[model samples]
Target: MKILTAVCVMALLVIASAAWADAPKRVKFTWSGGEAVAELNGSPSAESLWAMLPVTVDFKDFNGVERIAYTEKELSAEGAPESCTPDAGTLALYAPWGNLSVFYKPFRESRGLVPLGRFVEGADKVSTLGEAVRIERME
Candidate 1:
């Protein structure tokens, strides 16, 4: 009886982990230059951003490395990591300033930056985006 119970618990755990692994939501970003798809992780900040999707914002080149834009409001950062080392194609939020940042170049670890997602396509095109950009969920 104990062995059967243990097996059932392990099976449940495996199923739960699988569900969590597939929880990330995919979103698309489109601008005059091009478009890209990002896979957002399962964090409160990411969820907040996802909920506010279908949003249009203006983006600007920043520090010769990333494209930065301000969301309509700050996202929930309750469960976000303290810091992150962003690489090319990383999508993140600057918690303090409530701005979204898409990195086209590798960057050192920084604090108060919540990782939202990573671009799965056309990451290079981010650098060429014009001022107006649209973000929306992909089905």
Candidate 2:
């Protein structure tokens, strides 16, 4: 049946496309506002100046002593770039000069806190304002 063959092929294509869409997209972590600019491909070589894990990163109203206010042990239904996956075991870190958050893959554990990701605040996808690096990766 010609129609059946065409339908099968279309179904296969749809499945393939779905798989492709679910795959992670490689992206360089945006830590430009922090002291360390690192890439978040889950590579071992990335470096961070000020951030860590087993904690939640909170951004205060631009801080001189912006204390960490919360700890997000689990992030659910959160939108992430292709390179990031929010799992219960996802490790967190940051750059030293700023509150840059990094989500590392399995290999990056205990590597002296390297940065593999970051989150920015406000409407600007990229925030560059004042003495503060508005971009910070929380715990």
Candidate 3:
């Protein structure tokens, strides 16, 4: 009976995990010459970002590694894990500066950087994007 109970619990866990994975939060960004599609993670920071979507910002190249932009609103970072070695096409928030970071290149992990999402398509174009861009929810 104990073994059966454990199996049932595991099965429930798997179903829950699968349900979570199936829920998608897609976003998109468009600039003069580039566009990208991304999916936001189910994090508080990501949720905050989503709330402020359909915003326009002027993105600038930072450290030759990523495009950076600043938003007027500050996002909550409570319970966010330390970030490290962000993969290309990653979207993150730099808490200290309250700036948004869209990584075009891999970077070593750093504190105060909270992951927000990842690109699902057109990631390659992000590295070359510049000037004013519009970000909005795709779905």
Please provide TM-scores, in order, for all candidate models, with all chains considered together.
0.82, 0.27, 0.82
In each prediction, how many residue pairs overlap at the backbone (N, C-alpha, C within less than 3 A)?
A: 0, 11, 2
Question: What residue pairs are clashing in model 1?
Answer: none
Q: Write the per-residue lDDT of candidate 3 for residues 18-115, one digit (tens) a residue.
A: 98667878889999877899899879999998899888888999998999998878887877887646899999998878889999999988888999
> Alpha-carbon error at 55 in model 1, in Å?
0.3
Candidate 1, poorest ten consecutive residues by summed lDDT: 123-132
lDDT of 2 by residue, 1-139 (tens): 9999999999999999998655432222232343332223333322222223322234332232112222233222122232333222222333222233332223323322333333322213222322323333332
Candidate 3 accuracy as lDDT: 0.88
Candidate with the larger TM-score of 1 and 2: 1
Worst-scoring 10-residue span by lDDT in model 3:
76-85
As for lDDT, the candidate ahead, 2 or 3, is 3
The local lDDT score (0 to 100) that residue 26 gets in candidate 2 is 29
Cα shift from native, residue 109, model 1 (Å): 0.8
Q: Candidate 1: misplaced stretches above 4 Å? A: 1-23
